[model samples]
Target: MSTTTQTAYLYKHAHPFLPRTIKAASGIWLTLENGQKILDATGGAAVTAIGHGDLRVKEAIIAQLDKVAYCHPGFYQTDIAQDLATFLVSTTHGRMARALLTGSGSEAVEAAMKLARQYFLEQSPPQKSRHHFIARQGSWHGCTIATLAMGDFKVRKAIFEPILPENVSRVSACNSYRGMREGETTEAYVARLAQELDDEFQRIGPDNVCAFIAEPISGSPLGCMPSVPGYFTAVKAICDRYGALLIFDEVMVGMGRTGTLHAWEQEDVVPDIQVIGKALGAGYIPISAVLANERVISAFKNGSKYFVHGQTYQSHPAACAAALQVQRIVQSDGLLDNVRNMGMYLEQSLRGRLAKHPHVGNIRGRGLFWGIEFVANKGTKAPLDPSLKVADRIHQKGMSEGYDIAIFQATGSAEGGWNGDHILLAPPYIVTKSDVDEITDRVCRVVEDVFTELQERGDIREVDSRVESRKTM
Candidate 1:
């Protein structure tokens, strides 16, 4: 299984390295065919909220399969699908009127975009001109062409720029780490970002906009960066003033990833359209959703009476069943409480171990999701050279035979979105104090070793990375 012959037929993302074969996985650990047990620190890109293998999730999937696995979504409405949708809507406490489930976050986001467009098209008097979208910088929604156009993830969407939609625009992201001015308070920063967004809306002609989309807590693009205080409140006000919808893409931070059912709950700003994924299935299956509030639902109800958007697998019974069971387990186990308690411990442990490290530029995130940024000069906060691939190096090293740990790597920050690096640690919700200690220790070792090797080679830290100087908004 480890030999090249086994992977000859597959095309991999990192073609230079063959992916490891997992013999089994359970409770935050992956056992390789060679009997190597790798610690899963980042929960497979922050998706495995519950853990590696749970009999409860397995039984749910099996139960659905036994009943029925595939049926035309257009022809029949399965009980499991209805139950899951109802469960999701209830989590919103009636704020969200309906849940449209899909196979992935990208699909849900695409649906949200279409739903926004249709919402305006179906309005009284029909505001047909309202089709533009204003998204924040350093944001990542999805991979589809339209979703790509709305995202500020520079590297992923650069080659497709010519094919992307022209109706999308960007405002400065609310990144306090690099975007905040030296003397500005949180209120000033929020106001500044709000003004920038308002100006973008005016620049685009307010009547032409459909929605302002953002992540409640930014995922990979900004490396788990949370919004500055009052940032979302101001943004929401601007969106309301323009009569445009507000979309919160919580694909990577929602569904108990951030110690709550929704990341927006902590912000106290309920979004009109909320897109969620990742932990929705807790790695038991692939499922995501677009939740629409009553305003949008009522508009569709009064007008078209049906969403124009549909997929062959829109309400797949098996997917719904799996996710329903996953959410149930999260609730039954009271995992959010664990996420809060363990998350605090994980933060304290990481800061204690790596805060003073010379190359560690920033440590930020909430709940179990934490990001550690690396830089050549901690004082200047200048990113490490993208050419060095510091994040990739650390991630690969962590996954290597001796290290046997997995951490999420991120890049694409700074001007032009090309010269920054960080690694994320999002251990499972079931992790305890001991697990946190182990994860923190392994992460610190991996980060320190990578930088140490670079330092010894006289290749980094001797000079500030030539990427660019920090520019404050």
Candidate 2:
């Protein structure tokens, strides 16, 4: 079939360039229809953990289909579903008591929002007035209406603002790289953020706030930025003081993408409601989950005895089976250790190679999840023009050129959601030292080549004179 005929029916996002059509993916490489073998560097937005084409996960799905594939979640329960739920709950170490499976991360966040609202209604005092949610600036919870209201991703939420709920408010994200002041200590930064949240609660009326939702490790919109030390503890304290639930979105950074099983574990805080996806099913199936703490679950059990939420495929047997086997392999093969070891190696290699690049402003992340932010002036931390689409160029070059690497690109990470540009690198947990070396090499080359081309074309300008002056000083 002609390319035009094949792509005519598909409606894709508007872009200056069209993306390649992938024919197949195996392990950490994707084979494009044009005969290009590209390395899967970011796991297609940090989704794949165990890598592609696992025979065990395939067999598990087939085995599940042999018995039962589809069943109404409300009327019937499947053993595979039950097993997967149990496994998810156990990961929280009794902090979370129940799991609600969903089709994707957005669905899980939507469920978390509903559960947060229902939890307040289920209380003895019945906090019916507590319907508002507080999320951070530059946060991306999801794309659904309710989640869009809670998120501050301007590009995605701008047109939908009229339809989105108005009960949500925002606070600055705990992004130390940009949020921290010149002389601010980490403790001071945390306290400032906490006070900002407290002030927001007061403005919105604490009694009207149902929950404060945030990603343990900031995802897409913030480019994998982690909070300062003691940040979550301070935020949790504020939530507790105001009697509001704290929801953690671990969709991108959880499921062992970080060194820990759960990103919040490193922060020393337990969330009232937690959402996990992406690597949970390791791309073997489309699945995500919402895990509620005992407090939230107990409130529902004591009041309604139901979560007041349901989907036709909430607990698909085959999806659960695939996830269960993926989790088992992760544990049996000790992949978390690999993630930690290889993560250190990758971090060292990246910083050693690209940290001093003229446009590289910051490089930060945990375990296998890393992000490299670009800037027009490193000294001033000034971002490139948003119109330049620096991150998109790097991503396109990596794929099209001989680099043959796939890296995830993100925009609007510096200030709210406008000018910042960054690329996120989240390789599969099963990646080895050699794999990391190749990824680092290709990434460096891509960035350097892209910037060199922009400079030659006079499309890029020099750093601000003030920033250059500061460098001289």
Best-performing candidate as measured by lDDT: 2
lDDT of 2 by residue, 360-424 (tens): 99999999999999998899888887667889999999988589999999886865575589999
TM-score versus the correct structure, for each prediction: 0.96, 0.95
Model 2 stretches with alpha carbons more than 4 Å out: 1-5, 14-18, 462-473
Which digits, one per residue and each the tens of the lDDT, describe model 1 over residues 248-271?
Answer: 999999999999999999997999
Query: How far in Å is the alpha carbon of 71 misplaced in model 2?
Result: 0.5
- How well does candidate 2 score on lDDT at residue 383? 84
Error in Å for residue 84 of model 1: 0.4
All models: lDDT? 0.88, 0.90
Worst 10 residues of 1 by lDDT: 464-473
How much is the lDDT of residue 97 in candidate 2?
93
